[model samples]
Structure formats: structure tokens, C-alpha cells
Target: MKILIVEDEPELLKVMSVFLEREQYVVERATDYASGLSKIANYTYDCILLDVMLPGGSGISLLRALRDMGKLDSVIVVSAKDAVEDKVQGLELGADDYLAKPFHLSELLARIKTVIRRNNQHREQALEFKNVKLFPEDRKLLVNELEVCLNRKEYDLFYYFMIRPGKLVPKTALAEAVWGDSADQADSLDFIYSQIKNLRKKLKDSHAEIDFQAVYGIGYKLM
Candidate 1:
């Protein structure tokens, strides 16, 4: 899972990043509101740890902008002990959870899991197309009841395609989903075509009933 920690405290941010990394989450950090907003605007995450007080602006403002953009990333507002009103307002603005400072990291971790789990409950349903069966929770894929070995990028590409079924997925969208914020810095999106090419070969070798078909100068669709 990917998580963004929007905190200003140097120590707390480092501690949170290290702990979450040990727990196997990909973590990113932003120390102030401007950077936090930029991160959310450019990329997506499974959850965001937002601090109520930021150097440049209020984290509550960032939260509002995030929701205003129609981004549904699960958010947990982090605030100081006396900032009760901020916490309340954050919840009103659609924050999934909240934590007061001087809080237990364990409790914070629990809340993160709770919110992410609640949000992703709908994805628990296995996705199947033709002979391919994908179990999202298990991160496993099978074709004709046989496991299909896939590298990390290949699996990510396949999952993105499987979720939309026959819908055309633009290369830019694919890059953003797979590469996250790094997509913005990429010289070109040709890397996406290469990743898709490899994934297609794997599925074809496995006799997958569904295939990714290119629509010259446009994108690709599963058919």
C-alpha cells in the first residue's frame, strides 16, 4: 500500500516513515501544506496522514481542496491536543479518521488500516475475465486454474487493465497509476508501452482469454 505523510515535525515524520516502511508500506512525506497539496494533486495514495497545522497553510485547507477535486483518497487528520475544532471540521470535510498528537503510533497504524480497509472493501470481489482470475487481496492471478507468474510491474499493468475490462486506458493514465508522481518527471510515456508489451506477452503465453489491444495513436483496451 502507498501512504503520504503530511507532517511538519521532523522527528515524527521520520519515525512514521521508518515504521510504516518496516510494515511494508510505500511511504512519501511532505513537511508543509504547499508540498502536501502538490503531492496529492500530482499523485494518488491509499491513505494520507494529514497534520492540521502546517507551515505555509492549514492542513484543513489542503483537505478541503483534495475533496473539492473529487479525490477520494482516505485521509486521517492529525492535530494537536487543543485543536479540537480543527479535528471536528476535518471530519465534516470528509476525513476518514483523526489522531491527536502525543498519540500512540500503534493506534495511528490501526486507524490507517481501518480506513483503508473500509474504503477498499468493494475491491475484495475477485475480478475475472475469460480464463483469468485475479484476487486483489491475495495479489494472486491465475489462468485456467494455473498460477501465472508475473513481475511487479507486469502484475500492476494487468490489474489496471482488468479493473476496467474492455475500456480503453490511455498511456498517460497507466503511467500515473503505475509510476505515481514519478510519471510527471518522466521524459516520455514510452516506458508504459514497453511495460504493457511485456505483460501482453506473458498473458498470451499463459493462454489468457483476455488480451490488451492497441488502438494506434490512442491507447489500449482489454478484449
Candidate 2:
């Protein structure tokens, strides 16, 4: 899964990034309000760790902006200001949870997992499409109660698809979401094609009812 940390404290940011990376998450960082807003506007994340006091603005403003944009990305406000009103304001603005500074990294991990689990469950049957089931927290996939083991890239690819279901997903969006900033340097989308081919075969082997319908020169839609 991916997480965005909007924090200005260099040490705290580094520690959090290193710890989350060790836990096998794709971590992205923004030091201040502008970059945070830009990323929130352009990308989708499993969760966001928002610092209440930002370099250029208040994290409350960012949270409001996110909800205003109608994006449901999970947010956990991590800040030194642990006043009752601060927590209340953050939650009222749609933050999923709040953590004060001086928190244990392990506690943060647990909170992240909790929020993500809650978000996925709230996403209508844990993002099920037909007979297929995807457990994002476990990185597990099931078809007809049979488990299908996928490589890292394949899981990432299908996760994106499972979330969107029948909707057409652009290839560029897929690359950016799955491969992050590295997708911008790709010479071609051949890698995406390869991943899709593998996932399709796996689904067929597992007797999954869903299949990918490629839109020539465009992207793919689950059919």
C-alpha cells in the first residue's frame, strides 16, 4: 500500500519514512502545505499522515481541501497540538484518526492499519468484484474461495483494477499509481501489458468470472 506524510519536522519525517518503508509500504513525503496539496490533488493514497501545523499553512486547511475535493483518502492527523479542540476540529473536518507527537512508531503502524482496514471495509464488501476478494492489508487474493498468489506487480495491478471494477482505467494512471514517480521515465507501456497478461492468466486459471478488456491504444476495463 502507499502512504503520504505531510510533515515539516525533518527528524520525525525521516524516522517515520524509514520505519514505514521497513514495514513494506510505499512512502511519499511532503515537507509543507503546497507540496502536500499538490500531491493530494494529483494522486490517490491508501492513507495520509497529516501534521496539524504545516510550514506554509494549517493541516486543518489541507484536510478541508481534501474533503472539499470529494476524495475519501484516509487521513490521520499527527501533531504536537493535542488539545481537545484540535482533535475535535480535525475529526470534524474528516480525519480518520489523530495521533499526538512523541508517539511510538509501532503505535502509528497499528493506527494506519486500523484506518486502512476500516476504509477498505467501508468500500463496499472490502472491494469485492464478482466472486473475487482482495484483502489489501494481507496482500491476499481469493477467487471462489481459492487463493491465487500474485507477484508484487501483479497484486498492485489488480488492486487498482479491483478498486475501479468495470470502469476504464487509463494506462498512465496505472503506471503512476503502481510504479510511482518512476513511471514517468518509462520508454513504453510494455511493462503494464506484461503485468496484465500475467494477471489475466492467473484469473482464468483460478476460474475467476471477471476478465480484462483492453481498449486498443487507451487502457483497460474489467469485463
Candidate 3:
């Protein structure tokens, strides 16, 4: 899973990023409104932790901008302001949940999971593609009704492909999704090649019905 934390508090931002990274999530941080808006404009995330009060602009306005773009990334308003009106405005603008300041990290994590689950409810708890089944919450995969053991990166890569079955997934996008913002600093996509090679071998060895087909000078597509 990938998460973006739009917070101005240095300590809190570090804490949230560290905790979510420990939970196996690719976490990106934006300290103020401008940077947060830029991230919203450029990248995508499974969930966004937005702080209502920001240095350059209000998070409420940022929320409005997100709605205008029609991006349905699950958002949780993390603000010091606990006013009912504020909550109403945020919910009205399309926030999935709200977390007040001085909150427990455990509760924040729980809320993040809940919001993501709710957003993906249409797909149910498990994602299915041909004979492959992936339980996101449990981080498990099954093929032909038998469990397939996958390491963390393998599962993340396969899950990304599973959700967008048959769609062309660019190598850059795949790297960013699995490796997070740091992927941009890499000199080459050799690491991605290594992971994909192993993933393809595993799928073939398991006799899976679906497979990844390279798109020639582009990327791969699950077919």
C-alpha cells in the first residue's frame, strides 16, 4: 500500500512516516500545502493523511482541489481543529474520515486501513484475476485454490498487476508504485527487471492461467 502524509508538524510527520513504513507501506511526506498540492497533482496514493491547517493554504482547499480533479484517493483529515463545522465541511468536500490532533498512532493506522477498505469495497476483501486471488488485508495470494507464498516485493508487484488486469503498466509507474518516491533516484530499472523476472517464473511454475506480456520498449501487461 502507498500513503501520503500532508502534515506541517515535523515530529508528527516523521512519526507517521516511520510507523507506516514499518507497516510495509510506501509513505511519502509533504510538509506544507504547496508541496502537498504538487504531490496531489503529480502522483497517486492509496490513502492521504491531510492536515486541515497548513502553511501556504488551508487543507480544506486542498481537499476541494482533489475533489475537482475527481481523484478518489481515500483522505483522512488530521487537524487540530475538532470543530463540528470543520468536520462537516471536510466530509462535504469528500474526506473519508477525520482524526484530531494528539491522537494515537494506532488509531491513525486503524483509520487509514478502514478508509482504504471502504474505498475498495466494490472489489471486496479479495482481488480476483483469472485463477489468482489476492487478499489485500492479509497479504496472501492463492492460485488454483492453493496458497502461493510471495515475498513482500513480489506480492506488492503482483497485486499491482492484479488490480489493473490487462492494462498496460509502464515500468516507471510500476517502480514508483512498488518502490515509492525513492524510485526516482535510481540510475536504472535493473531492480524492477530482477523482480519481474522472478515473478514471471513463479507464475509460470505455479501453472497460473494469466501471465505478464512485455509491451516492447514500453512495459508489461497482465494477460
lDDT of 1 by residue, 47-94 (tens): 999998899999999999999999999999999888889989999999
Angstrom error at residue 27, model 3: 0.1
Can you list the residue pairs that collide in candidate 1?
none
Candidate 2 per-residue lDDT, tens place, 128-174, comes to 88899988777899999889999877888898898788899999888
Q: Which regions of candidate 3 are displaced past 4 Å?
A: none
Q: Considering summed lDDT, which 10 consecutive residues are worst modelled in model 3?
A: 78-87
Model 3 earns a TM-score of: 0.94
User: Which of 1 and 3 is ahead in TM-score?
Assistant: 3
Report the C-alpha lDDT of model 3 over 66-85, residue by residue, as the tens digit: 98999999999987745677
CA RMSD of each candidate after superposition:
2.9, 2.3, 1.5
Question: Can you give the TM-score per candidate against the true fold?
Answer: 0.82, 0.87, 0.94
Overall lDDT per candidate, in order of appearance: 0.85, 0.88, 0.89
Please name the candidate that would achieve the greatest TM-score relative to the true structure: 3
Predict model 1's lDDT versus the native: 0.85
